[model samples]
Structure formats: C-alpha cells, structure tokens
Target: MNQMALDKAAVLAEALPYIRQFSGKTVVIKYGGAAMAAADLKAAVMQDIALMKYVGMHPVVVHGGGPEVSSMARQMGIEPRFVDGLRVTDAETMAIAQMVLVGKTNREIVTHLCAQGVKAVGLSGQDAGLIRAVPHRHRSARTGEEVDLGFVGDVAAVDTAVLETLTTAGYVPVIAPIGLGPEGQPYNINADTVAGAIAAALKAEKLVLLTDVEGVRADRDDPGSLLSRVTVQEIREWMADGRLEGGMIPKLQCCITALEAGVNRVHIIDGRVPHSLLLEIFTHEGVGTMVVK
Candidate 1:
C-alpha cells in the first residue's frame, strides 16, 4: 500500500475506539486558560467540539471568562479581587462578569462553532434556570470566620434539561458560568465547578478541561513529570504528601468530583497545542492526565 493508504488506515484505526466509546454519549468540556485568549487555539478548540458532535457525541461546553472579565473590569476601573481562589464578586463585579461572559466570550464561542458547521447556542446559567446557586461560605484566611462574598456562589444544582434539548436538536450548548441564587441575585460561579456539576447531572462520558499545562505533574516545576493516569485514591495520597497544592488543588478536586459522580473519565489537557483534544481522545498516546474513579 502507498503512504496515503497507510495514513488513511491509521487514522481510521485510531478513531475507531473513541467512536465506539463516545457515540451517543455526552461529554462536558470546561474551556478556559490560554485557549480562550489565543485565536488559533480558540479555532482549534471549536473544531474539536464540532468534530465530536459530527461523530455522534453530545458535547456541552462550559466556559470561563475570568481573564477576560478581569481585563474588562480593569478598563472600567474595577479592581479584580479574589478570596480562597474564588473571585470576589460584588454587584458591580457581577454586572461586568455577565457582560464579559454572556455578551462577549459566549458569543465568540458560538460563532466559532457555527463557522465550523456546528450549530451552537450561547446561554448563561440564569437562562432557563439551568444552574442554581447559594452564597458560598467563605472562610477568613486568618480568623476562619464565614465571610460573605457578595454574589459569589457555589453550584447548588444543575438542570440538564436545556442542555439535553439542545444536544437532541443537533445543537451545541455553550454555557456561561453565572447562576441565579435563591434571593434572585445573579452569582458568579467557578467554571470548573459548573462543568463538574453539569457533567454529573448529565452522567457525561467525559469531562475535559483545557488549560495551559500539559497535565497534572508530580513536580509543579518539572514539565516532563506529567502523570498520564490518576485515580481518586492516588489523588488523595498526592494531596496528603503535599504534592498537589495551589491552583492544581482545585482542578484536581473538580476532576475527582466529576469522576465520582458517574463521569467515565476526566481529562486535563494543554489547550495551547493545536488539535490537542483530538490527540488526547483519539490516539493511544494521550496528551493529558486522565482521572478515573
């Protein structure tokens, strides 16, 4: 056989397993980090989602606009603030968050998907009450007293009906992380938590988080120390050993939560690389960490 024929055969062989595993199954993707800023990376991410939809996989996109929101807020003279890794959202901050997330970021993703021949609809957590939240308990870093962070919320519930309807109608649902709390206030949610909650509610087959790093590494400073596969027990051991700390702590927690809640697998991949999602999902040699229950 010629090289062309060999390449075609290899491609089919590589995709067969993933096609079988994911066909008719839901996959929730938490899209953020470098991928959100770089135009090329954004296009690649959209293409990956479109291909998954085309191949019979239901994809629900949960995206974060933290960096974007921060930039916008800065331009508007609003200083960004954080507490315990969660954004400190006041009423003004919530307004900016909604504008950046629902107005700008959400529409951009939807447009990209549509350009790739994938029908997509942008939505906020407030839309159709898809995600409901309550004021997240914030502990003071010094006193450990519960401090109220106005409009910052933890996802109390996820209604997957809208997502299911969109997916069934051959549309991809791109969700912005802004939920309505019980008091009729809009709250900003952490994107990872939103994705995990949605995936669990839908019993998704996979939850993929696109980030700047290759995957979870044993040594935070060592690029080649990526862990290919991890389990819940192993993660607990890593945390106990002080290996998982800082930003990775919350990301790993999200993955573990999703896995425990019936998600088949959770992947943390490098969004900077072109076609990273395809390489991770379709090839034997994946490009990220796979967390399993």
Candidate 2:
C-alpha cells in the first residue's frame, strides 16, 4: 500500500484495542465551552458522540448554557450575577435559565446528534427526578462569610435508572442542569456538578469535561505547560498553593468527586480542538489531562 494508506491503517490499528476495551462501557461527557458555542464545532462533537454510540460505547452528555443564559438575561434587561464562580439565580433568572438550558440548548444539541443519525433524547435534571437538589451556600471569597446563591442547587441525589434505561435502549441522553428543590422550585445547578453526580450515580467508566482551555498546566501563565497526566494530590496541591483559582477550582473538585465515587478516570480536555474527543479516546496521545487517583 502507499504511504497515505499505510498511515490510515496504522491509525485504525491503534484504535482497535481501545475500541475493544471500551465497548459497552459508559462515558459521561460534560459538553461546554467553545465546542458548544460554534456551529461547525458543535456539529463535529455531535458526530463524535454519535460515532461513539455506533462503535458500541455508550455515551451520555450533560451540557451547560451559561453564555446563552447570560445573553437571554441581557435581552430581558437583567444583569447576570455571580458569587464565587457560581451564578446567582433569582426566581426570574431561574426561569430564564430553565428556558435557555432546556428549551434552547438541549434541543440544539439533540438536533445536531439527530442530524448525525443517532437517537438523541433531550432531558433535564427535573425529568424522572433524575437530579434531586437542595439550596447551596458558598463562603464569600473576600469576607469569609456564607452567602446564599439564590436558586442555585447542590445535588442531593441522582436517579440512575433513567440513564440506564436510555442507554439500554440505545439512546444518547443529553441532559440540562436544572434540578428541583425541596419546595418543588426549579433550581439552576452547575453543569459540572450535575455531570459528576450522574457519573458517580452510574459508576461510569469515564467522566470527560470539554472546556475552553487546554488541560491542566504546570504554570498557569504558560500555554505550553499543559500536563497530560495529573494526580488528585497534584490538583489539591495546586489549590493549596493558590495556583488553581476561580473557575478551575470547581472543575478540579468535580474531578476529585468523580474519582472518589469509583469512576475509572476523569479527563479535562480542550473542546476548541476539532475532533478532540476521538483523539483523546482512540489515540495514545490524549489531547487532555487525565486525572487519576
């Protein structure tokens, strides 16, 4: 065969073992960042997910719509608020969040996946009582005082049966991050927390988060300092040394939670890179940081 054909064969050969290993295993993916925003990239990711299902690997998606929610809020003349990297959702904001996440974002994702010839089911944490939540308060970073983030929920429990049933029936479940509180109020939960909680509930084989930045870096300022493999201890150390701050703290915390809950591995990868999901899964040179215990 020619050189081009040889290279193609080599790529397929390399993926064979991984394909066999992950066949029938569940991979819960948290879809966010640039991949979710761009049209072409979003289509590519949906295709990647559809391909995973076609290849016998069960894939579930938990998505976030922060940017869309903010855009909608602005259109409605409500300035979005944040406290400690979590969105402060008042009742009105919560309504907007629900409409954005469930009506807009979830349907868009499902449509893309369907265009790729897969059965995509759109859902929310509200469906089938999938994600049960309670009010959450975080310490103020500046004052060290507890602050209630209105309508923001901390996951209390996850019902895994809905997910299992969908996967069993060869469906890709795309979930939104809105959950129900004790008073039957719809709360806006963080997508990362919802993904981690669902992965833990199902004891999934992998938890993959697609974000804007490259993987974890040894130095935050250096773009070339991406770490391919990271330990939970290293993440904790970074947190202690103030290296992991802002949005990254919660992401790393979710990885820690998934790892502790018996997940085989957790990955944080750059969603901006086209076909990154396939590269990370099928190749030895993963385009992400794999967090291991």
Candidate 3:
C-alpha cells in the first residue's frame, strides 16, 4: 500500500472508537458564524453532519442568523441594537428575525443536508411547541436597572416530542431559534441558549457550538492562550473577572447551563477550520475547548 493509503487507514482506525461510542447517541449542534457564511466551510459542516447521521449518531442542528437578520433590518431602515451580545429585539426586529430564520436560513440548511444525502427537516421553536418562551428582561450591568428588551425571550420549557419523533425516524432536525409565547406570539431567542435548552431537554451526549474564533482563551488577543479544556467553575471565574465578554459570554454561559442540565460535554470549535466538527468528535486531540462538569 502507498504511504497515503496507510495514513488514511490510521485515521479511520482512530475514529473507530469514537464512532462506536457515539453511535445511537444524540448531539445538538449550534451551527452559525463563519461556518454558515462561507460556502466551503458550510459544505464541510453539512458533510460532517451527514457522516454523523450515517454512523448512527442523531445530530440536531440549532442555527442562528443574526448577521443576516441585522443586514435585513438595516435594509428596512431599522438600526440593529444589542445588549450584552443579545439582540435587542423590538416588534419589527422580531418579525424580521422570524422571516429570515424560518423562511430563508432553515430551508437553506435543509437543502444542504439533502444534497449530502441526509434526510433533514427544517423547523422553528414555534413548531409543535418545541420551545415555550417567556419575556427576557436584561438588567443593566452598569446602572443595575431593569431594562426591557422587546420581543426577546428566554426558554420557559421545551417539548421534545417533535425532536424525538424526527430523530427516531432517521431525520436531522434543523431548528431556527425563534420561540412561541403563551399568546402564540413569536419571540427572538439567542441561538446559543436555544441550543443549550434543546440539548438539556434531549439529554444529549454533546452540545457543540461552532464559532469564528478558536475557543475559550485566557487572553482574547493571544491565539496561543486557547484553553483546550475548561470546567464550569473556570468559566464562571472568567466571567466574574470580565475575561470573557461580548458574544463569548453567552456561548460559555450556555455551555455551563447545558452541563448543569446533565449534558455530558460541551464543545466550542472554530468553524473556519475545515472539517472541524469531525476533528473535534473523532480525533483524540480535538480542535476545540471542551467544557466539562
């Protein structure tokens, strides 16, 4: 055999144990950021999810389209607003979010999965009461005053019936992070929080978040400071010390939430890297920061 063929065999051998271990287990993937933006990276992510399905791992995708929504809002003459990395969703923004997430983003993901020969169904939190939502009010960190974030929601409960049915019937469920409230009103929920809630509801084996950056870093500016593994306590300390900020704060907070809700592990991976999902799941040396209980 050629040297390259031998190397391929070794790689497959390395993945064997992981495949066996994760077979029949559930993984909730938070798909967004650079992976969703770039065509090549998007293709790689779809391929990874397809491979996971073929190997008997049930992968549920929860997606975010904040950039798309923001762009659309701007086009409609509305300036996008944010509070602590969460979108400040007014009524108009909520409508835009739903339209973008459910109408465009969800269908695109389903089409991509279909191209990979995986059966996928696109859905939103509004479907089948998947995510029951309540109003999410943010407290100003500086003023310590309560702030109203219109149409922004937090997950009150998750009914896993639809998700379970889809996974059991050999379908990958691609979910948009828009929740339904008591009055049947739609609310914009952060994708990271939605992913965590779904993972907790399903008691998933892993909750993997794909981001532009590598992972949790001791120093945000220093690439060499990436922490390959972290515990909940460490993440809390980092947040308390203001070491983690911006979008990273929500990502890590959701990781801690998932861990507390009995998820086995949470991973934050760099989606810019090709086949990063496979690298993180199958290799001994993963390309991400793994959060453990």
Candidate 4:
C-alpha cells in the first residue's frame, strides 16, 4: 500500500474502537475555557462534534459563558463579583448572564455546528423546563458559612425528554445553563454542575469537559505529571493531601459527582489543542485525564 493508504488505514484504526464504544450511546460535553474564546479552537471543536455525530455517536453540548458575561457586564459598568468561585448574580448580572450565555454563546455554537454540516439546536434550561433548580447557597471557603446568592442556582433536576427528543430527531442539542427556579424565576447555574446533572439524567456513556489545561496533574507546575487515569478514591486521597486545590478542586468534584451518579467515565481535556476531543476520545494514547467509576 502507498503511504497515503497507510495513513488512511491508521486513522480508521484509531477511530474504530471509539466508534464501536460510543455508537448509539449518549455523550455530554461541557465546553468552556479557551475553546470558547479562541476562534480556531472553537471551529475545531465544532468539527470534532460534527464528526462524532457522523460516526453515529450522540453528543449534547452544554456550554458556559462566564468570562463573556463578565466582560459584557464590565462594559456596561456592572462590576462582576464572585462568592466562593460562584458568580454573585444581582438582577442586572442575571440579565447579562442570560443574554450572553443563552442568547449569544448558544447561538454561536449552534451556527458553527450547522456550518460543519451538523444539525444543531440551541436551548436554555428554561426551554421546556428542561432543568429545574433552587437557589444555591454559597459556602465560605474559610469558615464554611452558607450564604444565599439570590438567583444563582444548582441544578435540582433535569427533564431529559427534550434532549432525547432532539437527539432522536438528528439534531445536536446545544444547551445553556440558565434554569428556572422552583418559584418560576430564572436562575443562573454553574455550567459544569449543569452538565453533570444532564449526564446523570441521561445516564450518558461519557461526560467530557474541555478546559484550559491538559487534564489533572499530580503537580500543578509540571505538565508531565498528568494522571492519565484516576478513580474516585484516588481523587479523594489527592484532595486530602492538599494536592488538588483552587480552581481544579471544583472541577474534580464535579467529575466525582458525575461518576457517583452513574456516568461511566469523565474526561478532562485541553480545549486549546485542535481536535482535542477526538484525540482524547478516539486515540489509544488519550490527550487528557480520564476518571472512571
């Protein structure tokens, strides 16, 4: 065979196992970080999702627009604030969140997927009451005191019927995490938490988080210290040892929560790399960390 044929065969070989494993199975992706801002990376991510759909894997995209919302708020002279890493949403901030997340970001992703020849539909958690939540209480990191961040919520339940309907109809569901509260009020939800809830509700085969870094590292300073695979117990041990701290702490917590809730596996990958999703999901040597139940 010629070199071109050999390369084609190798590419197919790398993808066959993943195609077999995920075909007809649902995979929920929580897309964020650099991929959301970088135009090239965003295009790559859409292409990867399109290819996944073409190969028979069902994918649901759940996205976050924290940075964009904050930027827009700043432009509007509303200073962004956070309590315990959760955005403190005042009435104005809540409106901005909805505009940026559900309106701007969601539509952009849907447009990109369509441009890539994928059938895509954008929906907020408010649509069809897909995700319901109650106001979330912010806990102090130092004293562990609980304070309510009005209009900010954690997902209490997800009605997966809409998601299933869209996927069954050959449309990729692009979800924004703005949910309705118990009182029929709209609330801003953490995207990672929202993704986990959706994955658990769907009993998805995998939950993939696209972030800025290359997965979880044993040493924060060393990129080579990546833990290729970890279990729930091992993550607990890392937390106990104070190795998992700061921003990564909540990400790992989300992964552990999803795994406990019946997600078969969760992966964390660097969104800056082109086709990172496909590399992490299909290749033998995955590009990021994988957490299994």
> Model 2, which residues run further than 4 Å from truth?
none
Which model, 3 or 4, shows the larger TM-score?
A: 3
Count clashing pairs, candidate 4: 0
Give the range of the ten consecutive residues with the poorest summed lDDT in model 2. Answer: 241-250
How do the residues 35-145 of candidate 2 rate in per-residue lDDT, one tens digit apiece?
Answer: 998988887798889889999999999999899999999999999999878899998999999999999999989998998899999999999999999998788988999
Top model number, lDDT:
3
Q: Write model 4 residue lDDT over 1-293, tens digit each, in one string.
A: 99999999999988898899889999999999999898899889999999999999999999998999999999999999887688889888999999999889999999999999999999999999899988887787778898767789888889999999999999999999999988788999888888888998998999999999889887888978988988889889988987776667767887887888899989998898999999988988988899886
Residue 203's lDDT in candidate 3: 94
* Cα lDDT, model 1, residue 284: 83
Give the Cα lDDT of each candidate.
Answer: 0.89, 0.92, 0.94, 0.90
Candidate 2 structure lDDT: 0.92
lDDT of 4 at 70: 93
C-alpha TM-scores of all predictions: 0.95, 0.98, 0.98, 0.95
Considering lDDT, which of the candidate structures 2 and 3 is the better prediction for this target?
A: 3
RMSD of each: 1.7, 1.0, 0.9, 1.5
Between candidates 2 and 4, the TM-score winner: 2
What TM-score would you give candidate 1 relative to the actual structure? 0.95
- Error (Å) of candidate 4 at residue 263 is 1.5
TM-score of 2: 0.98
